[model samples]
Target: MIDRAIKLWFFSALVWLVIGPAIGAFQSLQFIAPDWMNFLSAIALPYSKLRIVHTNTVILGWIVMTFISAALFMVPRLCNTPLRFPQLAYAAGWIWNAALVLDLVLIWAAIPDSFWLSIQAGEYAEAPLLVDVMIVAAVVCVIASLHLTVFARERPHLYVSVWYLLGGLYTTAITYLVGNFLVLAFSGEGYQVIEAWWLHNAVGMIITPLGLGTAYYIVPLAAQQPLYSHRLSIVGFWTLMAFYPGTGLHHFLQMPVPIWINEFAVISSVLLGIPVLAVVTNFLATPRGNWSRAFDSYPLRFAALGTLYYLATCLQGPFQATAAVNWYVHFTEWVQAHAHLALAGAFTCYGMAAGYYMFPRITGRQLYSRGLASVTFWCMVIFFPIFYIGFTWSGVATGASINLMGNTIYQTINITWIPRLSRTITGTVVVVGFIAYVWLLLRSLRVGAPYESGMNEVPEMGIETPFEEARA
Candidate 1:
């Protein structure tokens, strides 16, 4: 039952990975040529509506669904117990997917003449009231399923992965409800404050916790080692919960909000480095003696590199949150680049690594081609830096032209055209890697090598002892 549920969630996530990024690429093309995708407007859709669809679909549909599948697979195994409610898990997947579809429909179908189905204008919480209700129901099902599984654990001690999974599940439910519903209680300037809070926490609370948690689980396994420091893992988890929630306020520093709010957000954003360092150090240290394996294993490479990207994203985030830096980079391509670094670079890498590691295990089949996987990895490694650097440089140029030279917005856009065009080129190249990845997953499902159970375990590494003993 658990195996069936894992496959369902994972394949569903893959479907979204294909759909979400394709929407994103189209949106990118629209930026390069605004008049190109006019057919979309026939359905009463514009770039503004499609933007939220792309964002929500990738974040919720691809990243969240993939990580939830990982948690479903890992939690029961780590706890040495069966999943407590397999039916609920399965049902939640369908409901979640249905809600996402409804969300897109609401966005695309909305018109001035038919405003009933229109989404709220909130940044991340743009789903209509009906879709929001469905989301809440789906989240409830997920929480109940996971919490019951945790309660039924046969292992006396809970693993750090388990803590992350359970904590992320409940906190995300709270974050979703508050962001989508509670913020509606405020209007005027207060609404902006609450909205900014919701926007940042939507990523910080939901995606960051799940992404880091999945990394913690997958990294050591791919490296064929126990974690370097369990104590560090604990500290990382608590500090993350402590610092991430309030850091959302940094998004509104340029606004007329309270000064203390901005200061606290800056402090929290900077202090976020502690947990990031703790987790990255643990991952890097785990593969000390098995660095060769780390390179040879595609999943380890993804997880390890994802950790580094996570570090880069966090460090840049704090720098951008500072007053002087924020004044320049805010509302520019720099923020977009930073967002992709976290979402596309760090979390997507983790999700892809999870898929690479778990797909074969769940399906009892090998990946179709390691060479293809390597191609995908290298394509991303090459093109993402290209994408990031181009966008960052363009933004800095735009900011400097406007701030230092006192140029108008029109002049800034013209000054940044070359780098902007470079970004479009590199972004298109990155999509090729995405296509290769999706192809790998689909092909492996059909013709990959037969997988023998337990082949992932390494006795010499001493990694299987604790879990095996717990099961016994």
Candidate 2:
């Protein structure tokens, strides 16, 4: 049943959420405990390798799986159809699980850092070769979902959300091939540069679009309003497609790449504010004269805060792309703050909101609790700023001190223990927030009851659903 699939994906995603952060916390502590963490210390175990495992699990395993769950739930309903091959979709789910297991195996088997380098050359090894195969399988599952939903069915104009979904899948597959095979594996002296370029683009293209697209679809719907402007949505989509890929080079701000490429990336990253502002304008316009509606609705609160965070993240994103700022912030915890704000604060908010909005409709059951959802939203809002300010403060303060300490960079950076300890504290706070979120969601899913009578109602738009009409 739909309930089982929903539960399966949500639970699996939560498992990753728990494990990824725990590993990340351990990784963060290594800055202070380089030699002292006896239980964790190993000669062969490189930080780079552990970091990759942590990063990839959170990004690919957690985000992708959770997004897939949301997509599976939404595509069928929006298209007014059931999944074409539910069994195949279920099988695809198993493939994803198997892939994650294989990834862990490869990690445990001591996949060399050189194996990742092979990604750029478009070659594979015994271990990385397996990782590559797993990635391909995961992508195949994604492609199948796309084909079944958008390609297989007859419908009116394709929804904007579906367009973004398909676009994300297509570009992800292309980027995987180029990043892992062509650029990283094939290119040597310039391999790191290319890989970073691809990573930057992949995050922008794949994760942001899919997350934003899902929000675009669900937020207005939850608010019980039509999108403020379809025209603006089109503008947002096309401009994003044109600009986002080009912004990848901003990560290499001072590095030795073609000057033209750096300039191109700088301009594009900054210009990306245009599409971001456009979407913000569109979303803000949705609540014209109805701002109180957002206050009243749990889902609306999440959506509104997400839009605000989007603005903050994009503005900061382009600002950091500048060479002047990158000089001080590059590879610092400042960058980490930017990343968590974008991925965790913004994208994850949208994802969680979408999950709450769709779950009842998809399951043909009312939500378990609006009260718990409200608690989750506020926890998220409060959580983001605590980590944001702490990490940014630590990054700027420490970065400045390091620069001023001595004539040489290494000498300046010698006093790092306290700063690293601060980071551990900041990361711990973020983990606590995540724990709050998991608890709130669990209560909402299992214990809270469906809203009764007037409590269930959202404001009116033009929804024709029995649930909507009844709630209204």
Candidate 3:
């Protein structure tokens, strides 16, 4: 039952991996030539709506599905027990996908806001009241399933990955409700404050911990190493929960919010480095003796790349949140680029790592072709940064010309033509990688090489996983 359940969510995540990014690539074309996407407008696929769809699908759809699949696979193994209720896990995945479809369909419908509907308020929180209710139901089911799995544990010790994932899921529920429902209770300035909080934390609290938690499990396994320091893992986990929630308002520093709010957000953003460093250092150091394996293992390489992207994101996030930097970069694509670094850049890589590692195990077969996987991986290594650079370059260039030089929009528009073209081209290239990845998965299922079942065997790592060490 659990096997069937894991496969359901895993394949669903692969489906979204292709879809969500394809929408984004199409949207990028609009910037390259405003009329390029005019046809999409005929079906109400205009850039405004499509942008919201792309973000929600990728984050709530793709990343959320991937991590849930990861947790379903990992929890029972770490707990030394089968999932408490496998059917609930299976039902939750389907429910989550149903909610996603409703969410996307309603977005395309462009439903108007009403007392009951709450069509669109914040960036990713744009789902209508109906969609929000469905999503909250799905999240609740997931939370219950995971906790029940932990409760049924035959092993006494819990792994750090479990800690991060369970804690992350709880926060996901809290932030989602607060951002989507609680804000409805307020208006005027308070509403904007809630929007800003949800906007940033939608990534910070939701994606950051979940992605990092997936990384914590995958990195050591692919490298065939014991966790470097349980002590550091604990610090990273605690500090993250402490500092991340308040930092959400940092996204709104330019607005006329309270000075105290600004100062608090800035302080919280800066303090995030403590957990960020601890986490990154732990992953990087874990592979010290087995660096060669990363080159050989697709999972490790993607995980390693994810760690680097995460480091770059956290370092840049706080720096930009500062008054000196946000004042400048906020005007440009810098914030958008930073977002991609976390969601599209880092977490996507982590999702890929999870899929690449788990798929072979799930199916009891070796991957069909490492060569095909290489095509996807290299595309990521080469084109992702190109896309990110072109994106960041376009924004910074536009911001400086308009904000710094005091040039009008007309003059700056002329200057931005080439950079926008570059952004579109590189973005399309990144999407090609996504397509290749999905194709590889489909093809592997049909022709993957035969392999022995590790499902019944002891874990290859041989280290203790009854729980995370240095127990709280």
Candidate 4:
């Protein structure tokens, strides 16, 4: 039953992966040609609505669901127990996916005149009130199921992965409720401040913890080693909980909110590097002397690269959060690039790594093709960097033109046209790569090489040697 739930969540996430990036590619085209989507205007699917759809679909539908699947799989294994309430877990998956679909429909149904049906315009909390309620309920069910599993653990000691996963689950439920409802209940000049907190926590609290938890579990396993430092892991986890919740204020530093709040946010944002370094150090050190194994293993390769991207995203985040830097890049394409770095670059990579690692184990089938997996990895590695570089270049050029040369938005657009065009091209490469990835996943489900049962030998370097065993 738990295996079925994992497959459902994982495959559903891949389906959203296809949908979200297609919308993102269309959004990039809109940047180049504002009227490109004009034909769809008759149906009220404007850029704003589609933008929300893209963000929500990728974040909640793809990244969140995928990580949840990882949690469902990893938590039980770590605890040495069966998943409690398998039926509830399955129901939660359906409810979560349904809420995402309903949220998108509500966004589309909100014609210009029918504004009431539109979702709340919060950054990460854009679901309609009803959709929000449904999501909260789904999360509640997930928490209950997972917690029950944790309580039934046969393992005497809770592993580090268990700490991160259980803590993340509890925090996510509270974070969602507070961001979607509690914050909205208040009204004042400080509303924007409150909203910023919610927006920041949505990413920092929910996605970051979940992504890190998945990585922590996969990294040592892929490398065939114990964690580099258990103390560092604990420190990293606690520091993340302490610092991440307050760092949202940096997003609104240029606003009229209190200056001290912004300063604290900046301090917290910069200090976040501590936890990032600790976690990265632990994972990187664990792969020592076994790096070549990663080259041969697709899951290890993905996990390794994901950690690198995670490091880059964290470093870039602190630099951008500084006041002087924020003044120039806050409203520019730089911020968009940064967002992609975190969501698409960092967490998406982790989620995919987890999927690749677990799918074969859960389904008892080898992947369809190593060559195809390599292609998918190269596409992401080559194209996503190009995509981010083009966008960052466009942002810097546009910002310089506006601040230094006194250019209008029209002039900046014309000046940055080359990078914008490159962004669209590279984004298309990413979308195609993702499509192929999804195809590979689905094909493997039906026709991949079958796993031989009762082969329990731990090969050298902790690699799965059977597929290569036959090839050799």
lDDT values for all models: 0.83, 0.67, 0.84, 0.84
lDDT of 2 by residue, 1-472 (tens): 4446655665677677767766777787666776655445465456655676677677776776677776666666556566665655566666667766676666666535564412212211122645666676666765676567665655544556666766777777777666766663445538756666676876787787777777777667666676677667767888888899888778777787778988898899988987898789877877776777776666677778888888899999889999878778776778888887887778777767776665555444455556655656765776557657766766776677665553354543455556556657766766665666566666555655564333322222223323344445
Across residues 137-171, which tens digit of lDDT does each residue of candidate 4 receive?
A: 88888888889999998865566777888798888
Candidate structures ordered by lDDT, highest first: 4, 3, 1, 2
Q: Write the per-residue lDDT of candidate 3 for residues 30-133, one digit (tens) a residue.
A: 77677758887887678988898888889988998899898888878878788877888888888889888988877777656565454676778888888888
Which segments of candidate 4 are over 4 A away from where they belong? 111-117, 452-472
Q: What TM-score do all the candidates reach, one by one?
A: 0.94, 0.85, 0.95, 0.94
- lDDT tens digits by residue: candidate 1, 107-143: 8777443434567878888888778888778778877
In model 1, the runs with Cα more than 4 Å from the true position are 37-45, 111-116, 455-472
Find the candidate with the highest TM-score and give its number.
3
Clashing pairs in 3: 157-466, 157-467, 158-467, 158-468, 159-468, 333-395
Candidate 2 wrong stretches, greater than 4 Å: 1-7, 33-35, 43-49, 111-127, 152-154, 362-375, 404-422, 443-445, 450-472
